[model samples]
Target chain A: MASTGAVTFWRSAGMTYNAYSNICAAIVRNCLKEPYKSEAVTRETVHFTTTNWENGIQGKPVTHEIFK
Target chain B: MAMAAMRREGRRLMVISPTVSLNSTNAVRSPLVSQELSLQGTRSISTQIVRTRMKSVKNIQKITKAMKMVAASKLRGVQVRTEQSRGLWQPFSALLGDIPSMDVKRNIVITVSSDKGLCGGINTTSVKVSKAINRMNSGPEKETKYVILGEKGKVQLMRDSKKDIEVTISEIQKNPLNYTQVSCLADDILKNIEFDALKIVFNKFQSVVQFLPTVATILSPECVDAASETGGKLEGLNSYEIEGGDSKKEILQNLTEFQFSCVMFNAVLENSCSELGARVSAMDSSSRNAGDMLDRLTLAYNRTRQASITTELSEIISGAAALTG
Candidate 1:
């Protein structure tokens, strides 16, 4: 209730507090030194595979990788 | 007649090949062979059962050994991350401070559990603690709702406390855990539920073999304001001077949201590490049990085979003596 006028600049920019904080975390993670930075980055990566099924037939599997 | 009986015996032995022994059903069907061979057929059946049981135990042992190795390696990674993630939330607690115990009308219990089971009693312990909290906190004026994170807890709490569960989030442990992902989840939870106080229940990783179910509280900003007004207990806030005077409430709101995310992030990491460590030990015990079972089964199978072989040798010696007489 006390948060009316005190909304951060990011809140005014249409970002929920969640998104703003996540961005902040991402920045901090990027700024980490050397091996930790590399490990953090690697920890954020996600690689997944999917296959399309049309009717009863099979399809080739497609792999997608996410690096953040 | 003697020749015919010997030929029948010879044919029966030929049919009892290794391949036939593999199908224990062949021995089961041997009652149709003749009455005299029934005893031998049952003996072979028991031995075959023991052999197959041993094979299954061996396979299970292999699986558990592999699982133990996998959990150990995964524990190393999560344990490191959990240590680093602790830094994320410790500052917030130091700044906002812990209220210790707060009596609020509405409470949300965020139950952190794992997606997959077979780890240990980590999920059970969390569920038990959460249930106890609910039991203690329930009253006519007070209400408690559960926000279950992970499938295992949902399945458990659904049995008795299904009505108390507000939201069930799954697939969290499917991918590698990270801040961004957890933050997003926290945001969604904030939007979905409204509560005066949040009590996060998770297994705190103590060591490779030790994990304790811990409950950490995060007071909503409204509750924080009320607590400050009633008791003026937020002396920690007085220590820090704010640069922008008008934005104090805004900062608190953002900080609250950020704190929620940080605490949730750390809880998730800690719970995961505990799960992996629990898995390592559980799989290790499982493998050990399988080994013991294999040993017993091998002994039983060997004894049965030896007994059957001795019976055949004696029968052959008697037949030779009788023929000579």
Candidate 2:
């Protein structure tokens, strides 16, 4: 009876592990790809420019020539 | 005597590490007995459960892949606009410096964020800044009006504050920002009511994983003047007056509009980039978490399998001995 219970538990565990592995593999391959990756890049670029502008304008000399 | 010795060794191994001992004992202790058949039945059921779980994982992967692709396409447009707007900042600041300051009664703050989520804390950070501003302005019973970009920000602000949200625009795309819409918004602010100042709050994308929330005074002549003076001082160049046919008022009018539009353009670009960065980081973390879960589940499965095999062998050995004796 003890042996039978142990066998049942192992069998169930093995099945669950196999299922979990499949799901993880799918996530890595499908969802985190090209367009999604590129989208992140684009957002970073926008952030860079805005922050730079904010810093540059904080307190600088105004040359009238640049306006011309 | 040999069988007794083998059993003793197995018992010792089991004492040291039960899981490893269980695996070894299962195979060694197996006997040709009716009890062994029962162990086989349990194994089959466990296998079926594993198969079902694997199917669900596959389905989840497909959805994540689709979302990633969509985010990538939108990112391209966002990148282009952000780059183009880089040159506009200095000029816009210079123009702002030229505008004369005025004392007004009302103030409006335009906040840019994203309508959709999954791009991490971009919307949250923007909202936090806006909320802070709102609190600072609200005294006794007075409220500050908000011109919010993106449905998420609008919804969040409305839910939290539920006060003086002037306008919420939700139709803007991710990139190659539509200055036309921004212009319309600026115009509305300028014409509808008399405002003392105009401020813009947005995300300033620093890197792949760093997006800093920033607040800028958009309509303040003082900030513009400060920007101009800083730009000049940095270059170590002396200031000179414009020597052209254009009159002061004409120049001021042109400069003011230019400054406003440019600032609007910059804000949009920054907000988009921050949104993208936030999403990427969020997705990366999600992937890692999935990996961790897989590892734990795999370990559990292995342990359970070993336990089951050990039980089966013990039952078989006892049954065989009983039959023979």
lDDT of 2 at B263: 76
Q: lDDT per residue, candidate 2, B1-325, as tens digits?
A: 9999999999876665754455567764444422344445665347556545645654565555556666667666776778787677666554343222222335567788887789888898899988887667666545467777776887687775555666565545533455444454454444444454666788986776888887766544333343445564222212446567543333443445446656776887888877876776676666556556556666666777777777767766876886687
Residue-wise C-alpha lDDT for candidate 1, range A1-68, written one tens digit per residue = 34366455677776667887667767988899998998787666544333332332324644444566
TM-score of chain B of 2: 0.70
Judge the docking of candidate 1 as incorrect, acceptable, medium or high.
incorrect
Q: Which stretches of candidate 2 lie above 4 Å from their native place?
A: A1-68, B1-58, B69-77, B97-104, B139-143, B174-176, B188-194, B220-250
Docking class of 2: incorrect
TM-score of each: 0.79, 0.60
lDDT of 1: 0.79
- Single out the weakest 10-residue window by summed lDDT for candidate 2 chain B: B96-105
